[model samples]
Target: MTDEQIREYFEKVDKNINESGYHLTNVFATAETPSFCYSTGIFKSFNIPEIFISSLPPGLCSEIIENYVEAFKESKEAKRNQRLDFLTERFPVYLIDVPVPSLKEYVLSSIKIYGDEEYKYLQVIYPDTKGNFPNDAGYDYDQEIMGEFNN
Candidate 1:
């Protein structure tokens, strides 16, 4: 989809969530575990840092993974540059990151796109953060990794 289409899609989703009174991030939720993430860089174009890392041509995931793992833990300004460096090494036919709302939806979308009659390879990794939401999410941010910050 073009950038305009993407924007429209997001706007629709945003409106639905607002009317439903759900968290903006919860746009991905549907029943079961709503906290899963999917790698769609192989399918279509989307934007995010991960899109670049996951969509490499071939034999590049290993190198990308090594560099990306480091990026997550690094603090230097150079880390972002390194992230971009490893990502552009192999451009998937498409983009970098695509966020789906749930595990089932993510899987179904992939199957529809990549199955024999139907499943393509989509890798999903769900990260769990063991912290409660701040009393005021409207504050714009939260604690980092550990400790307790009120944002």
Candidate 2:
């Protein structure tokens, strides 16, 4: 799709979500690929971020709005839930942090698995600091085997 077409489709999803009474906090589109991601927060608050990523090559653009609408409907039904639960239930999201201030090594090491034949895309949604990666996310970031289940 052309840039204009991509913009139009994203706007359609945004309109649909806004009409449903939820506020969209951010939408990030990649210029290199036909992929776009968006996050929704409760009543315009940014404390909670529920992200959705879609890869709309060319023909699949038609379902963008429908997908967003369905997600919005489901989210409304499961109101005030944990974003971590919502994400991990659908995707293989995990936490990895090497102790002794070498987290960069661990993150890069795990990201290597994304290049393997099985995984098509890898989306890492991290906050500004390591301290911000949600404490109650079931595991401590300081300990864990990197890429154990991700690969």
Candidate 3:
């Protein structure tokens, strides 16, 4: 994007962040990558790790992230490695720590918006219909759809 476009986009995001507590960014899928969505201002507003989810439609991802943020705000107990069964009825989702190396590649907008300061992030991952995660045997989903989770 051009500098002017980037500035306008950031301004819009800032406006949303000011109106609500956060702004959700939905990235459309490309031929080589699956769709993903993330939240900006979660950490700045709640002191919690920002949320990220992949391989899901933008609407569903937005719902999950918004709900998760609400839950975290109410209880302040959500954290990495936690299994959240309430996000989806079809399957439970796991929150994994997003490695530093992956942040630049995936959550660059958040990085820029947050002034490139240190902040935490958690990746929401769900298993296939068989209830098997990426590293588990019998997992049937395409691994590329979820991107790389070094953690």
Error of 3 at 22 (Å): 1.1
Q: Tens-digit lDDT track for model 3 on 55-81?
A: 777888887888788778766667556
How does each model score on lDDT? 0.30, 0.32, 0.76
Q: Considering summed lDDT, which 10 consecutive residues are worst modelled in model 1?
A: 118-127
**Per-model TM-score on C-alpha atoms:** 0.23, 0.24, 0.86
1-151 per-residue lDDT for model 1 (tens digits) = 8989867755664454345321111123345433332333232221122212211223443444334435432442222211133433443111222233223443443343334531122231211233223333342322111112222
Compared with the true structure, model 3 gives a TM-score of 0.86
lDDT of 2 by residue, 41-128 (tens): 2223222223233332222222332343354444543222222333323332322222312233222212222234221112232221
TM value for model 2: 0.24
- Scored by lDDT, model 3 comes in at 0.76
By lDDT, the candidates rank as 3, 2, 1
List clash counts for every candidate, in order: 6, 0, 0
74 Cα displacement, candidate 3 (Å): 3.4
RMSD of each: 15.8, 14.6, 2.6
